[model samples]
Target: MDPYGDTLFNEQAAQVACQEIAALTLRCADDQRKAALLDLAELLEACETTPGSDVLLMGD
Candidate 1:
């Protein structure tokens, strides 16, 4: 989770991230943030199902 670099999560990590994202989405009060989390969760879930695929989080 770097703020100035890139972070990558493999299938196993993506599965865990997806679960955490789902829980965060549920607890989030802001609609915009919740929506973004949901979108990220979807991408993580996709990576979880695709072999060798990873979720690359690019930081600014």
Candidate 2:
């Protein structure tokens, strides 16, 4: 994971990322953070099931 560059996760990594995001979503106390995590988790899940799909994280 690079903080100064973009990160891309393929199907296999998306599955793991989605699960971790879901777990974090459950433990998050802030509603906004939870919502954002949920949205990310949803995207990761979609990427996980779609062939050749990936989740990209752009860093600032």
Q: Tens digits of per-residue lDDT for model 1 on 1-60?
A: 466898889999999998899888889999999989988888988999999999888885
CA lDDT of each candidate?
A: 0.90, 0.88
Question: Candidate 2: global Cα-lDDT?
Answer: 0.88
Inter-residue clash pairs, candidate 2: none
Per-residue lDDT of 5 in model 1: 93
Consecutive 10-residue window with the lowest summed lDDT within model 1: 1-10
Q: Quick one: how many clashes does candidate 1 have?
A: 0
